[model samples]
Target: MVDPRRAFALRDAFAQQVTRRLKVPAVEQRAYADRLQAALDGQTLGGLSGEYVVLVDRNANVQALFIYFRATPSDTWQMIGASPVSTGRPGEYDHFITPLGVFEHTPANMDFRSEGTQNDNHIRGYGQRDMRIFDFGWAQGQRGWGKGGISEMRLQMHATDPDWLEPVLGIRHSKGCVRIPASLNTFLDHYGILDAEYAALAESGKSLWVLKSNRQMTPWAGRYIVVVDSQRESRPAWAPAPGGKALAKVPAGASSAD
Candidate 1:
């Protein structure tokens, strides 16, 4: 387990590194942490002592990723940092809704760096060259295309095209994977935030070329990314939509936990 003092220190350090901060309140942060714990418990992934975990709310109104850490299985999860992200956006052919639940990051599905090549549409689907792609292997997702049905899709989290895609990160717009900011990708990669398995392999003399040579890894390296949908009816002030405005209005009787 991580020392409590050290965990707090790491939290502060991570906060400073985030380029685009999602200013969530303490109560909301705790609520997201509660959801993370629930997902872990549902998947029987408890006992992850002193580990950091990435939590993403796939709710369209709140396309945000939260970094959380806990010193022990029974300890309250504390927020490290948060940033805007783009999850799966349905309605388009070949698009799949981002799956909900806990996904473990392991060496079984090795990660790779993006080639930074633009597609036919001149869009860099995987951001700049050398950006690490956090692969979670194949996952069954609900297809967004015609005659929609469950199908196996490759799950990955990486930086999106900086010019076009990155600016629209707060909204859902991906082919099933999670798209984050390039700065956040570098932060996660440089700190080994979710590289627990890779670190373990490297410690045993296994060379992982994907890892950055100058990475300052944390002892609380995490392996899990828990995704949940808050099902908010409207956008919250803290989580603004694309143009920095809460465009969606909250209807009467809607929950305030947007």
Candidate 2:
């Protein structure tokens, strides 16, 4: 029951916003025209479709996709990576509610190293350090939930389960990982076009391929804001790097370890 036209328009607006935030070249703007055409063709968006980046809003509930294709001119808006995830617990237990920004897949976090089955979200990549979070403590409201740590060992996309979809419907869920659902997890892990943030920028050459791609609780006037483009070698952007837990060593009456 949503307006797809408005959704596309909003996608363009926010894509510009995020592109400005990153401060890239103005010439890259043309890249969006092609992306626009592809979106109309039916690129649907769920993974690193072709060559692009994805943006999510932490300050707001918005998710957008920008297709950055360079190698071979393809008219398809591929879904890359995304943020604004509903991680951990919603309220009290959800310590790591991540923010909105550009994060990439690093070598250490690549989930393909494991010689086992990882049909879940942990197959994307891992974090630099254990990802600790600070999110709302309840299911619907926003209050500090103290802090918690998620090992840098599980970088996730979304969920691959239908039953596990509701919690992520603009609420909060997951255990400190970028999430999706069975509906779109495979596409995301399969494309892996956003192998690195730099590649993302190179894909677009400088513009954003915007689109309103999430089917969840969106409070934005339009649909959502997504930034699909590439970038140059920067600081790998800013990702949340959590520290060690600050819990007490032991109780006053408890005995010490050997």
The C-alpha RMSD of each candidate to the native structure, in angstroms, is 6.3, 17.2
Each prediction's whole-model lDDT (CA): 0.83, 0.30
Q: The CA-based lDDT of model 1 is what?
A: 0.83
**Tens digit of lDDT per residue, candidate 1, span 1-258?**
445548667667667776778899989998998888888888877666587889999999999999988777778888888999988888877788899988989999999999998776667788899989999999999998899999998889999777667777788878889899898999889888899999999999999899888999987788988889999999988898776433243122111000
Q: List model 2 lDDT by residue over 1-258, tens digit each.
A: 543223233334334332212222333335444444434334443333223344432321222223333222343432222222333333444334443223444333323311222233422222112121111111222222545333232234433223223222232334434433332333333333334432244356643222112312121121112322232232222222121231132122111000
Which numbered prediction scores highest in lDDT against the true structure? 1
Model 1, residue 99: C-alpha shift (Å): 0.3
TM-score of each: 0.91, 0.35
Candidate 1 weakest ten by summed lDDT = 249-258
